[model samples]
Target chain A: MAERIALIDYGAGNLRSVHNALLAAGAGDVAVTDSADIVRAADRIVLPGVGAFGACMSGLSALPGMIAALDEAVCRKNRPFLGICVGMQLMVDSSEEHGSHKGLGWIDGTVRPLAPSDPQCKVPHMGWNDVIPRGAPPLLEQGEAYFLHGYAVESDDGADILATTDHGGPVAAAIGRETMIGVQFHPEKSQRYGLALLERFLKWRP
Target chain B: MTLRTRIIPCLDVRDGRVVKGINFVDLADAGDPVEQARVYDTAQADELCFLDITASHEGRETMIDIVERAAAVCFMPLTVGGGVGSPDDARKLLLAGADKVAVNSAAVARPELIRDMAQRFGSQCVVGSIDARAKNGGWEIFTHGGRRNTGIDAVAHAELLASLGAGELLVTSMDRDGTKDGYDLDLIRTIADRVTVPVVASGGVGSLDHLVAGVIEGHASAVLAASIFHFGTHSIAEARAKLAENGIPVRRN
Candidate 1:
């Protein structure tokens, strides 16, 4: 049977685009839903988010049983999980966007704004940037990916830093622990490189 | 490298088909916006803008299906504009799979709409599109396909939109539009310099050098052109190469 990938759609993210990208990456039977049962039943789970950390976190929390299901599926069951953009930031301790908001606290880190030393490095970091791998994580590759965010995750344990990208300095581009992985860049939007990463992610045994 | 300067292909669509006009008249068929979007996606376009140009004249929501179909096939961030009158309309397009919604003439009519959209959908998803013509010392804001003049200063309007929570600004030069001469560097620089949000320069991109100038000289974070990419004058790969050669940071495959 194909992997039952449950893509958490809690009224956030470019859900349709992510779904399509997954299909292009050769993944099958992907479900974009808010149902906790489907999330718990999935063999692999993906939480894709687009927007502010506080807003995304609230949206996720608004759904009853979703987070607990995710905890069971990802934290307990140790199903292969992926978080993209704000989805990645949600696994952190808290965010300093709009106001200081709490996060999932799964990774023990804070989500803070990217303050680039160069005035030219605009906020929202809106465009394609390099993704350089720092530590080996299953299926993780180094390449450019499309990024559109102002806030980034700062993990407490530096060992969790799987990849880094230069904004002004080394910004956390990808992080992982055990079977879970998160990337600041939108692999779905990175074209061939993105497609390659997604394909690797689909085939990853972790 | 830092974030690369983006090269975007603008598709002005009506009734779900891509169309290009001359001075808002003599419209010609280009292609299906969805098909063109897929082509650009394969070409690795940094982003895409699908602006529905027939909003004020005809009242309909044809872009929902277009957004859904294109988004289903393409993976890049897609911005859908035109006929986004209320937050519900924007929500519909978003639910159908649009990443961002660009508000143009309607925003000019009521600048507060920028704040409203920003509040509803995070400011990052709200793009303020301004059409301007060089007037006097500055530039005059125009709407309705550059047919209506608002008499508002372009720089002031750009700053106002940013303050109102527009995360990005799409600034089009009416005077240089379709002329293929080049971007209005002074106009783009003034608006880009005045506002903190990333500004996308539209209109008058004749060649690859024009795109580079928009980024290096105009300080535009991205350059959007239609006829050049659509008419097969230059591919996106060629554009990226030219930008890289000129010492500007660009995404390379």
Candidate 2:
């Protein structure tokens, strides 16, 4: 039987595009669901998010038992998980966007506003940038990916830094440990590089 | 390297179909916006913009459908503009699969609209579009496809939009729009230098050099051209090559 991949819907993120990308990447049983039961039962999980960190956090928290189910599925059951853009930022301990807001804290980090030393480095850090892999992180290959964000994660431990992209300096582009991974770039919008990453994530044993 | 300079192909969409007009007349059907978008995606264009040039309110729904269909197949970031007057209008397109919504005359009419949309959807999704024509000393904002002058300074307006929370600015040169002269570099620099957000240069792009100029000379973060890519004047790969030759970092796409 094909693995059931749950694409969590918390009233935030580009749900349709992500779903389509996963299918394009050859996932046969991808479910776009908001139900905790579905997430807990799924063999793999994908958490996608857009917009501000505070709003997305609130949207995800609005759903009862969703976070607890995510915790069980990802932390306890050890299912492979992936997060995109703000979804990746949500894995950090807290975010300074729109005041300090609590995140999933699944990874040891905090989301901070990107203040690139170069005045030329624009905010939102919009457009395609390089993804340089570090320490052979799973599901993260060296390539450029589409990025659209104003804030980025600052991991407490360098071991969790899966990939880094340069704006003014090194910004954490992808982070992970064990079965969980989070990417600052949008796989659905990253074209072939992004689809290839999704394919790797779907086939990844860890 | 920093973020690569983006090359975007603009599709003027009307009633669910892609169309290109000269001076907003003699409309010709280019093809299905979705199909065109797929081609651009395969061509490795960094991003795509769909401007809903539908003149009638009734045609707006069709634009939304087109956007949703395009988003399903194309993986690149999509920015949709035209007839985006309110936050709700932007919201519909965003929910319909647009990554960003560009506001033009509406943002000029009610600057708060930018703030409203940015507050709800985040600044990353709100794009402020300015169509400007060179005036007495500086450029002035023009509306209705550059038919009406708004008597607003282009540079000041760009600053206002950025401060209001527009994630990016799309500035078009009305004077050089169809002349194939090149982008209004001084105009782009004035605004690009004033704002911290990324700026997209639009209007006139005759050759690949214009694209590099938009980034290096105009100080624009992205260059948008319609006829050049749509009419087969240049392929996206050629444009990337040109920018690369000029020492401007561009996505391999």
Candidate 3:
């Protein structure tokens, strides 16, 4: 039987790129759709996002039945779900990018700007950086991934962090709970390691 | 984990085919944009640049087609430039799968365009491209594919672009472009020192040593080249190997 992968599209940015990347990562049954029924039916779910937190949250909530469908699929159904970049930020309790914007509250954290104590550290934190695994998550090896974001997840509990990266100081790179995982990097942009990670996500049973 | 230095391969496209020239003249066909982009991505190029040297209305449409096709197969970050007149133009390119849109002529004509792009797409997606030629005493910014000098001081304009919310700078030296001599380290160093954003050193890069100099001496966040990588004289793997040997950290392919 083929795996049905739902690449969620609630008009978030980088959807096309993520779709193309999912196909590249050997997902034979990848479908980019906005319908909750499609999302609820899929065996796996991938959410890709970019831009500011306020805008992204509005875009996601703009579709009437999206949040409920996603809640049922990810939280209730316990399906394997993955969030990228701003999508990962949505897993936090809130974001401070443009003000305090509420998030999905799936993880105990707030999305805050990467204000490295050192003045030399640049904003947006763009480019490829190493993702050091804090605890072993299936198929997620320690390697570099392309990261481009000004804000990151400030997890309330250290146990929620699956990985970390340094930009003047250590920042949350990936978070995990059961089969659900979120990464603050662009696997589509990170060549080999990214493809490998995606392949692992596809084959991940837990 | 450390942030790795990037190596970018730039492909100038005209009517959907890859073209090359020295200082933007006497163009020669290299290959298909899709082909070259796929090759570079598979080779693990940090990023690929697709510059539409011909900015005609029809050419813009063709560039979009090229981007869509290349993006379907290439997973790495792609930066598109060549006549982004407005935020809408940048938006179209970004929607078509470009990770970043570089503005040069339009940005030089109206500095507000840079701010507008940044405001719309966020500064992280806006790249300010400057082609500079050494003039009397210093370098002046050039536009229209490096055919015209704008008389604007390169460093001053770069600072303005940065202040206007440009996330990155792509500085090309006209004197050294296609010369196979080496990058203008002095020019790159000067502008890099003044800007807080990442600076990409473009033009000239004949040898591996030159790539090293771009990071070590010029202090560039990335090094972009055309002929060397296009002509197959040097590969991204080779450049990364050389950079690592020289004590610079680069992502392995």
Candidate 4:
């Protein structure tokens, strides 16, 4: 049977780009759905989002069955799980944007705004940034990828962090333990380098 | 670490195909926008800017269909401009998958338009585009594809635009346009110092060294050029390598 990948579509951001990116990266059995049954049966799962952290949490919270399915698939099955952009932050405990919105709490951390000390450093941290890989993961062996975000998850659980990118300070880029992986940058939009990273994720054996 | 100087490929679209020349002349017809966009997308360009050069004069709605089509094929964030005079226009383009909307003459004519668009959308979505020409030993702002002079100081105008809520400035030196000599570093430095937001230096980029100088000496956030890339003179990969060799941190392919 083909390895199935379930992309969670919570209607909070762009799903087509991520779906297309997976397809382009040679993912054969990619399915974008919010159905619990499909997610539970999938071989891997992807959570993608683009927006404020509070809005994303509300959207995912509204889908209780999907959330439960994702938790079971990731925690119980130990199937590979990847989160992009705000989806990565949702893996943390909470966020500072629009009040303290609770995250999925998969990883122990809190999301906060980018530092405001450097007047030269623009917010939203839009465009390409360098990534310093911490672990010897094939997914992040490649150097850097594009980044666009206003807030990031700062994890005290340093073991979960796979990479860091510097702005005013070093911020988490990829986080994971066992089958759970979260990338703060959009691999779907990082051009060839990003596609390479996604391909590594698809081929990752955990 | 030293920031990488971006090598941006600007596409000026009339109808749907890309066109070019000094002040939007010569009009060499390029391939379909989607196809061209895919080419650049594969080339690993630092960024892409698409200007709907004829949408306003032609009295047609913004070519949102084109934007959507291009976005579908290319994953890089696209900056769309031309005929974007109002917040609604910015919203429409953003909704159509454009990462940002660049306003030129419209923002100059009514500076408040910048703040309004930035407020409705976000500051990150607003880009202030200025076409500048040398006048009386100083640069003057030009409007309507550099056909009319605004008699405003380019440096002062950039400062005002940033203060008015422009997240970035796309400053093009019309006098050096299409000349392929080098970027006007003098103009770039003046505007870069004036704006708090990112400054994208445009016009008259000839060599890889020119791109490096624009960022290192001029302190530009990014550098945009045409003809050189469109005419197949230099590949994006080679340009990036050169910049990186010079200690500029480009995101390598």
Per-candidate RMSD vs. true structure? Answer: 3.0, 2.6, 3.0, 4.0
Give model 4's docking category: acceptable
Q: Model 4: per-residue lDDT, tens digit, A1-206?
A: 77999998786555777877788887999888878889999998999887678778778878859889988999889998989988898998898875888888888889998774777676657678877889585468646577767678887758788888877678888887788889988787788777887888899888
In angstroms, give how far residue A155 of model 3 lies from its true place. 2.5
Best by TM-score: 2
> Quality of candidate 3's docking, in CAPRI categories?
medium
Q: Clashing residue pairs in candidate 4, if any?
A: none
Clashes of 3: 0
Off by over 4 Å in 4: A1-4, A34-42, A62-69, A116-124, B1-3, B21-29, B56-62, B85-97, B109-125, B133-141, B149-166
State which candidate, 1 or 2, has the greater TM-score.
2
* Residue runs of model 3 more than 4 Å from their true location after superposition: A117-121, B21-30
Candidate 2 Cα lDDT to native = 0.91
Q: Relative to the unseen true structure, what is the C-alpha lDDT of residue A154 in candidate 3, on a scale of 0 to 100?
A: 91
lDDT of 4 at B135: 92
Pick the winner on TM-score between candidates 3 and 4. 3
**Which has the better lDDT: candidate 2, or candidate 4?**
2
Task: Judging by DockQ, tell me the better candidate of 2 and 3.
Answer: 2
Could you arrange the candidates by TM-score from highest to lowest?
2, 1, 3, 4
Error of 2 at B200 (Å): 0.3
lDDT tens string, model 1, B1-253?
6778888888888776677511222224335677777778888889998888664434246678888888888888888888777788888888888888988877888999999888767777889998899888789999777888889988888899999989899999999999999999999998888877799999998998899999889999999998888777888899989988999898877
Docking class of predicted structure 1: medium
The total of clashing pairs for model 1 equals: 1
State the DockQ, from 0 to 1, for candidate 4: 0.32
The candidates' DockQ values read: 0.72, 0.80, 0.65, 0.32
